[model samples]
Target: MSAHPENRAGLWVALASFVLWGLMPLYWHLLKVVPSLQIVAHRVIWSTLLVVAWLLWKQGRGWLRAALAQPRAAWMLALSGALIGFNWSLYIWAVNAGHVVESSLGYFINPLLNVVLGVAFLHERLRRAQWIAVALATAGVIWLTVQFGQPPWIAICLALSFALYGLLRKLVAIDAVGGLGVESVYLFLPALAVMVWGEAQGAGGFLPLGGAPGWGLGVDLLLVFGGALTALPLIGFAFAVRRVPLSVVGLLQYIAPTLQFLTGVFVFHEAFDRDRLIGFVFIWIGLAIFAIDGALRARRTGVTPVAAASEA
Candidate 1:
């Protein structure tokens, strides 16, 4: 069957967002010379500027006032902001530290972890297939830990943090962009402080100043653009969600991590030995089961999955 024009456009937008997210490691890799903390701080600072400017243009200054009017919402968003900030910091650090492959695994595990969180915190019941999927993914982590003599803590932390962030966002009443703007406001001062401290301490990477050998103009441009990059995909996701079916969006979510995994192996030349492959295979099978079950359930019920688009 032919899809409507809006639906088609939504699909394309969603793909673009996921592709951008999938290829984000390359962008971060370009800033590998900068400290991860600085990169993240810049991200926060510039993202706040861009997002706040956008909000002003789109909805006016009243949006922020309205958001802050609700004290509970403000506090919840503050907590969610911290979680996403930590996720961003860890992800950038992982990419530069030769752990891109492990980082990708975290995102691959994220959806499943979301399901588990729903069950644990929301008191939602999981379907049999979901239980199997979670069990298999758990086994995969265990296998990876036993084989490597250490857990894939990078991946685990990423998945857990993002899942919790998603959970908090779900509870908040504000729209995604508004919530993000609030979070950015919460983070703006701290991030700016970090940037100032780095420069004062002669460790900044933005410009040739304070005795630090700066990365040059190209790096500076990338850092400035990082804010737009962070917000663009989110805007795209928001647009796409209104037009696309939730089930399809859920399926499309895999694109980003899959691309990240490929980038890790092909671009960065990260090692993926047989031992790691076995563990990933288990997770893959679990994810396949989870996707298939969700699809079948949606089809049978004549309803789409009711999930909020995550900012992770």
Candidate 2:
């Protein structure tokens, strides 16, 4: 079927979002000297300010007031805020700590994890192909765990946290940007506390602390600007999802992880031995099955697989 002109535009926007997400490892790597937790704290603070301001400008004060008045949505966003905050912190830490490949694996597996969550918690039925795909992914994880002599905890944490966050957001009534704004607001206080503590302890990077290197204006600007950087892709995602087919967006979601995987292997030169390749191959096969299943189902239903829109 041919896409509408607006949807074609949305396809580009969606691709842009994924590309930015894919290239994010390089951005985080630039601030490798900063502590991940501090980076996350700044992310929370700046994102809250930027999103809130955008909400004010685009939607006006009434939008924020109305959203804040919805107690259930507020509570839901609070939980989601925690999940996303944890996910961001871990992802940043993983990239900076030279675990970019594992982090990429986490995001690559996130969609499958979302499927598992849907079946387990939402009581959704899974087709045979989906079951096979899940099994393959599970085997891949097992292989990686055995190969490494431990589970891929970084990937698991990133996948589960993000999956749970998407699930909660699905249950909420707010629009994407508004929901994120609420989440940022919910997380603001704790993020502020962390930043304050970091400064007090001389560990903060954005702001010069007593014992730390004096802050360069460049570093401070980058730290504060992390807010806009965080919000932009999400804003693009919000725009694209509303305009295009979810299946299209789902296919595009892989772009980010692909970039991350390449960055880890080619750019960062992290270890990629034969055993790790075998494990990733299993995952690649599983993802192929999953994508085929989705395409078939989308064709049959004349609608995109609802589950495929789980990207967050």
Candidate 3:
């Protein structure tokens, strides 16, 4: 049977969003000269501006007030904001530091981590296949750890931070944009303070004021555009979720990390020896099992899986 027009459009939108997310390493790499913290601060400041402007336009001036009306949601969003800010900072730093391959692994592990979080916090039960998938992924981590003689801390931290952030967001009673808007507001002051301090120390990246040797206009533009880059994919994902099935979205989530992996190995020429490949292969098999199981269950039950909000 032919697909509906909206679904087709949604598929394209979803694909675009994930593609943008996947290619983000290249974008951040362009600003490798800038301090990772400065880049993250700019991301917060500009993302705040864009998100707040969009919210005001769509929901009117009372949007912030409405979002903050619930005290529970207010505090929850504050925590989630902190978590995401940390996630963004680490991710940008990792990309610039040439840990893109490891960073990709973190995202690859995130969905499985989500399943574990669901079981622990939400009292959700995993199917048998899910149990096996998680176990296989765990073994992969252990193998990687043994091979490297140390843990993949970058990947592990990213997965943990984002998983926790997703958990908090799931419990909050706000729309994705609204939640992000509030989170950005919560982060705005601290981010602005960082920017101000950096400039005062003559370490800023945007302008050469105070005799700071700023990178250049190109870098400045990329930093500013990072806000839109961060937000547009989220907006697209939100739109796509309403038009597409969750199972499809779940499967599509792999695109970003796969592209990131390829970018790291092929584009950046990062090291991916046989040991690393073996570890990744184990994780990939586990993910395949997880995806196939979910699809079969959805087909049998005739119930679409619940759509997850995009963390990218």
Q: Highest lDDT: which candidate?
A: 1
Worst 10 residues of 2 by lDDT: 303-312
Residue-level lDDT tens digits of model 1 in 6-109: 87898899899999999999999999889999999999999999989999999997988998787589789989999999999999999999999999999999
Q: CA lDDT, every prediction?
A: 0.90, 0.87, 0.89
lDDT of 1 at 41: 95
Please write out the lDDT profile of model 2 over residues 184-300, one tens digit for every residue: 988999999999889888887555754577467787888888888899999998887876666677678889999999999999999999999998888888888998787676667
**Stretches of candidate 1 above 4 Å error?**
209-211, 304-312
Candidate 2 off by > 4 Å: 1-3, 69-71, 207-212, 304-312
Order candidates by lDDT, high to low: 1, 3, 2
TM-score of 3: 0.96
Candidate 1: worst 10 consecutive residues by lDDT?
Answer: 303-312
**Residue pairs with backbone atoms closer than 3 Å in model 3 (clashes):** none
The RMSD of every model to the true structure, in order and in angstroms, is 2.0, 2.3, 2.1
Q: How do the predictions measure up, each by TM-score?
A: 0.96, 0.94, 0.96
Error of 2 at 282 (Å): 0.9
Stretch of 10 with least lDDT, candidate 3: 303-312
lDDT of candidate 1 at residue 87, scale 0 to 100: 100
* True-vs-predicted CA distance for residue 167, candidate 3, Å: 0.7
